[model samples]
Target: MLVEYNYVIICSDRDFSLDLKFRLKKYEDLAFVSFAKDKTEGLFVILKHRPDIVFINLSKNAPEYFKMVVELRQYFHNLPIIIGISNDKQYVFKAIKNHFFDYWLLPYSEWDISKSLLHAKAQIPEKTEPKTLCLKSYRDFQYLNTDDILYLKSDNNTTCFTMKNSSEIIAYKTLKVFEKQLPEQFKRIHQSYILNTDCVSGINYGKNLCTIAFNNSQVPFSKSYIKNIDELKKKLAQSAIFANK
Candidate 1:
């Protein structure tokens, strides 16, 4: 199945506005929902259409770009693209720090928009099944299907694999080694822990933590890994959609 990418363009300037819109529309997969002249109407369109991407102009005349970014971040945190357009390097740096997917200078060609749209598409995670992972250690090596593991925790020189059966597998493998062994659904949820997305039952955003409930065991989601938890939730949601089909 193919999904349509919807976009909302919020530009204060009339010049080059339609050109940009036209460029985005050229991709048959993407469709424009609304175009606004100011931040107020821009947000209205964004909320109404729930666009997959939003292109905003970073200019003094376009209200407070920083405030707009902050406000939109709250409402559309999961939206794949929040592109800031400006020629100022300082402004672009600030936007990047705030976690906008990409930024571009003004008077950009259609090719630039095409390049960015492609990049944003690449960022969205695709749904896939977990694979069996085998890791080697000094004494012995074990192989288990990825879905059978709850999480992996590293302590000094020993890395422990918490299995769905509540049994622990102690291996001398580093955290990085196991990370590479797992699939995309396996996420690093803590400095010392890598999570199995399938095992995570729910997340507590207020506590900045996640709860991975296995058959007889539970795993904790740490503060440092909250972002990865959120991302994994989105991937799991996307996977569920496919499974239902």
Candidate 2:
């Protein structure tokens, strides 16, 4: 699936918004989601939608908008890409200090906006979370949400996928083939098994086993994959309120 970026525009200028909308028709992937009249409303809408990009009209109260963006830090570790629009070149320095994506002059250069958006696309990659895994064989095609997959086991040349719903799906392909295709959350714990780390509730170092919390099933992990297990432990520990050895 092609990734489409959602954007929110915070501008009181209707003419600029209309013009920008007309110009953005050329950009198929960049879709506008919501619009706000002022910085306060912008903050509320931004927090609600969490768009990929935010265009702020910095011509008025640039400092206040910057402060509003800083306030958003309490809620998000990573903020949206902010593009400042103003008639004053003075705001460019401020925008840079605040780490804005790009600063556009009010007169609006079509080429400049296009170039900036291209650069933005290069910097900010497509959101790949909760991806869909497509399985195709001959004329048959099966689409599975990667989030619903618990783990995969290799049975000779075929791979069996265990879902969160307790249903099993068999793909006429080797486990090694899908090993590289699945997201980072799915890890190769054994030669025959690749487990989804999200589904793992606990790891028994003594038995070299991982507990799948989804169904309370224990899966074995060989000593050879202890490094991956250690990293997984540390990754999961960061989200825990407290952990004791």
Score each candidate by Cα lDDT.
0.75, 0.87
The TM-score obtained by model 2 is 0.54
Clashes of each: 0, 0
Clashing residue pairs in candidate 2, if any?
Answer: none
What is the TM-score of each predicted model, taking all chains together? 0.47, 0.54
- The residue-by-residue lDDT of candidate 2 on 1-245, one tens digit each, is 36788888887887877777778878999888888878788889998999888998888777888898888888888878899988889888878888898998878888898899988877775676649998998999999999899999999999999999999999999999998798888998888899999989999999889999889998889988888899899988988887575
Worst 10 residues of 2 by lDDT: 121-130
Give lDDT: candidate 1, residue 102.
Answer: 85
Clash count (model 1, backbone only): 0
